[model samples]
Target: MRNWESFLRGLLISLVALVGCWLVAGPTAHAATSAPQTPTSPPTSILGINLTGGFTQQPIDSNVISGHSVTLSAKGTRNILETATNPLGSRKYVWWESTDGGSTYQQVGTNSTTYTFTAPEVTKDTPLMFQCEYDFTGLGLFYNEWSRIATVTVTPDRVPTTDIQVSADSNTLYNGESTTVHATLTPDNATDPVTWTSSNPSLASVDAYGNVTAANTSSTMDGTANDHGTVTITGTSNGRSDSTKITVGALQNVTVNEGSDATFTLNNLPDGMTVANWYKVDDGTTTALNSTASSYTVSKTTVGGDNGTAYYATLNYTVNGSTKTVNTNAALLTVNKSGLLSLTAVPNFNFGSTDVASVSQDNTTLENLDEATSGSNYDGNDNGELSVMDSRETGGDWTLTASLSPFALSDGDTGQLSAVILDLYDPTARLDENIPATNTATKIYTSSDYDGQTFDVTDSQLSFAADPKITAGDYQSTVTWTLSVAPS
Candidate 1:
């Protein structure tokens, strides 16, 4: 009996300890599995913006002029976590303009990279400023800083309103000459077209474009006399008119000796005559010469052609409230030739430095100073003759040869250039005669038959051809010319 009681007491103590432990662990596990987890914050967002592209604050003077249109552009860029992304879908742009410095602003444009606006006209100089604002609407709506200010100036259009004046490019003109007249309006924006008129259409005529042409006249032929007349030109604009007078005068006569310098003078010129001009006329072709004074000296070349070559002089002067361009009579030039054959030296030809794979040519002309005669007419049998003999006394019909020597350029390198050739043209044959690369004296020119009379001949055009492969340094060659009797 004593052993059974001891066993029951031990079993009871063990059951109580097991029950306590089970109760504590069940509640702790339940609390852990059923409780709500701590809520996490949403992913942070990083937004960035900028104003770029063609945005600049330039000087007012450098901008477009008034009454003109200008375009302003702005570029917007966005990034997420410092990485570039498209901002077009989430952003908008607004452009503003300020005409009064920065005191006030007006919305000029929006939602575009470019805005075209016409500059307003002003009485005085004005400044215009433009800026752009970017609006961000993604995630949350926000605004970006204003873009750089672009400034320009609008200059006033000063149209002529009063004291309208008219002027002319030239106040005087000779017969068959023209002058241009222009009107000055008070304001630059004046739209009135100027009407032009001539006091005497028989003396001078005015065109719609303000061009005035002097009429033809038959005047005196004395060496110092001129036919003088006046014509008034009027320019009318906005019911206002201005008039200018133009004077016309006759030409005088002059005489000169052949192969001698001749002086042409306009004596008894009208008062206020300050400018003088001289011209040479040959075969209906006119050539202007440098002669500012009342007198001009004719050169030997000018008096070397035919015996009856003529020249004229024009005097610019103001007379009786009018400006006039009066012409002098035809100045007859007499050329006296001793019937001798003469030649003028030709200038040296320089091809200049060239690179490889290129071709170069030099054109030179030879002049014949002999006078033209019946026998030696331009197209006659005894026209003219030219012959070349080798300097080394090479006999017979000689030929011209070319030899290119090796040269050193500025780089201190030496090389030989080749394929050099010479070309001569025959006026009678109307063909080109090319000289071969051989050392022979060539007769470049020879008449078909020789006549006793020597006449002025046309120029001979000589050309030298050089191959690009020739060394770059300065290369020189010698050509010898000798005059010989014509071959029978």
Candidate 2:
């Protein structure tokens, strides 16, 4: 019986030790399985938990088109709950949209890890941004997730009204001359590109690539001149477009005149153009053209030798891809090789002011008038000598003094005298009185009276003129007398 008791006591002690070991081992294993997972290190305590997540942001430009949207996403990372059995207790996600480029955030979505935002309207040259946040909480621990702010830009796709510009705002072309009509498209915003086109194909045509060509139209077209036509050009860029109209014409009336060079200039011409003269005539000798332009003169060497008249040539120009002509007024000039005496008068007389003086007299004639053999000769055929004099102030009564010093004055020896006054003070000054004892006073002079007549000489008088209210300090005009000899 005593031996049985001893064995029972030993067995009981062994059973107690085994139960203690089992309890401790079970608890240790459970703790290992339940602990939070950390990539860097083991958790110091199971009670403490830490979680981390990530968010991604995509910029959805606030200025994008109506159908466009921006996206933002949150990704889970460094999850404290490693196993499905140990999941977080709660999850929260928030998304925000910012119209002011993320300056201020407004809630757009909640309770989601990802969000997509779309803009309603966009302004030109504006910026936009968006952002989101995620939170995870379980077992008395907090996890945070954030997304980088997404950014986008807003811009207008439509173009505003714009003005059309030309590379050469003005152009000039002669008959049969061709030039490019360079038109440029301009947008209200300098940053935008432009498109160009033309309206009137008959008068002028323009290509999409900004090339201008010429067209033909009869005098029958309405709103167009008998010899001229108009072309319309349209320019568009973005959503805006504009049109411009230009006129085209022909050199209807061209003529030959006496000029320094063989060149002639067109009158009433289109912008940015010059006149070119072409003369084809069979002169006894070959004809040479003048050096100066705007008008043409027969070559002094060829004028008298040719019996028949030379006709002026036509002028042509291309504007905006179409041809236009410049009309020149007809001017008939004849060169006489015979030596003759002629006269021309240069008058500088003031009817309003009492200060009157005769610059020249009637016997101012030129001798030996003939066609010019040399260009430098002043008194040659087409050229005449110029004799000038100052106003003769001989008291209140002005007298025209003329002298035939070297030659006798004959009935047919005609001459002209002109007077010019310097510094005409008041162009509006009235005639003080007629001078000299005659039925009707032949001469009028400047008025000293303040209560004199006023005249409108804005277009007629020179720029250096005082108001009608005359001042004593202001001087009258300087007297300049000129003499010109005409072909006898």
Candidate 3:
């Protein structure tokens, strides 16, 4: 009995200990029997995004001469779960460009899936680099690694580098003339057009198609003398050029009277002319004049030799260190013979009522009777001019004289009015030579057209001066005109 009772007490103590353990461990066992749960993927990582679909390698320019342009595109596929709430932020792409072999970078595109790039003017082999970046902004604004770099090769335009030469049809041209010029390039395949220019536009001008026209150094009309010079023409093409030279010549003519000085001139003497000579050709003999200037003159006494004598001029010049000579056209000379001398006087000049300190004039009519003969030896026309005619057999230059008697009024008062001076003008004098103070036998007119012809002194004028104390009645004066031959 004592042993059984001890075993029972031990059993009781063990049971009590088992119940206390069950209360503590029952919740732990229940927690372990629940359904299995899936492992978490760390909130679908938004970082480490990837970009694709752009130029993976360098592209060569095909149309280099004109220019080149292309479109570049990129896409973001991974880490795009945030695109539904923020489409722009999740799939955003940025483009970057590098022109100096990636030494520097520049942002070229943003907030888009694609981009376009245009190259600047490239004169040589040029390289360009491009890349793209993907962004995920939903979770702390994350960015993906940059895309693989893309390269592009651009070519440049072509330039000309050949030589050009030019030539003209004529190296020498006269004023108011033109010639055509031509140009030649070394390479026959060159397509560049040639341009022309003149060193002296006043001396010569050139047109676009290479037509060269001669111009005058001085500002003169086309058909006048003294219109000439020299000029240089140049042609250019493709940065290359050449030049040529041309010369222009001058021309002229002259004439003179029998007993007057005759002069000849080289109208437009060209440059480099060292000397000039004048020559007279008579009866097949050439005589050199004593003058070496551009102009030569012959005296009146030496010019009355023949009716038709030829005179010419020659110019000496240096061309490329060599002496050269050029001749001008011949000019003709004329001489005439001496004839008779005569004159006619106009009627008395009468002044009507004249006041003191007043002036008046009267014209007379005078005609040369010898000048009325038909078929005369004179070279002047019958223009009714006041003239002196020389018809003497031993004829020479002649002159006409006028003697004006003192003016007297009808009242016969010899006062200051009577001493009034008379002046006359031969309106038809050869060189506007006039006669003044007609109180003495003053020479009036002279003529060298020695012929038995008539000349009219109808333009003669007589004047009267009135003093304060002189008479105021009608006054009259007589003018006596006479002619005499001039000594040779």
lDDT of each: 0.48, 0.36, 0.50
In angstroms, give how far residue 128 of model 3 lies from its true place.
41
State every prediction's TM-score relative to the real structure.
0.32, 0.23, 0.23
Which candidate number has the best lDDT? 3
Instruction: After the best TM-score superposition of candidate 1, give how far the Cα of residue 27 lies from its true spot, in angstroms.
Output: 99
**What stretches of model 3 exceed 4 Å from their correct place?**
1-251, 301-306, 334-488
Clashes found in each candidate (C-alpha, N, C closer than 3 A) = 23, 53, 12
**lDDT per residue (tens digit) for residues 299-415 in model 3:** 542223544565666667543355656555455555443332444213333222333445323322222232332322233333334434333445476666667666555456664
lDDT by residue for model 2 (1-488), tens: 99999999999999889867644543121111111122122111110112212321221212234335644444333333332323635556666666654446667677775576564465555565555555444333344445556554545553343554544232322212222333333432332444566565644555433444443323231212232334566666555666655544433322222121232233554333444554433432223343325455444222333324433333454434555554332222333322221122222322232221211212111222133332211231232222112121121321222221111112324331122212222234432221211122222332221111222222122212122322222222222222232222
Over 4 Å off in model 2, which ranges? 1-202, 207-210, 215-311, 314-488
Error of 3 at 422 (Å): 39
Model 1: worst 10 consecutive residues (lDDT sum): 41-50
Task: Put down candidate 1 lDDT per residue, 368-401, tens digits, no spaces.
Answer: 2234432111232223443221212222332222
Question: Candidates 1 and 2: which is better by lDDT?
Answer: 1
Output the lDDT of residue 430, model 1: 58
Best by TM-score: 1
Candidate 1 segments whose C-alpha is farther than 4 A from its true place: 1-263, 266-271, 281-291, 297-306, 356-416, 425-431, 436-439, 447-472, 485-488
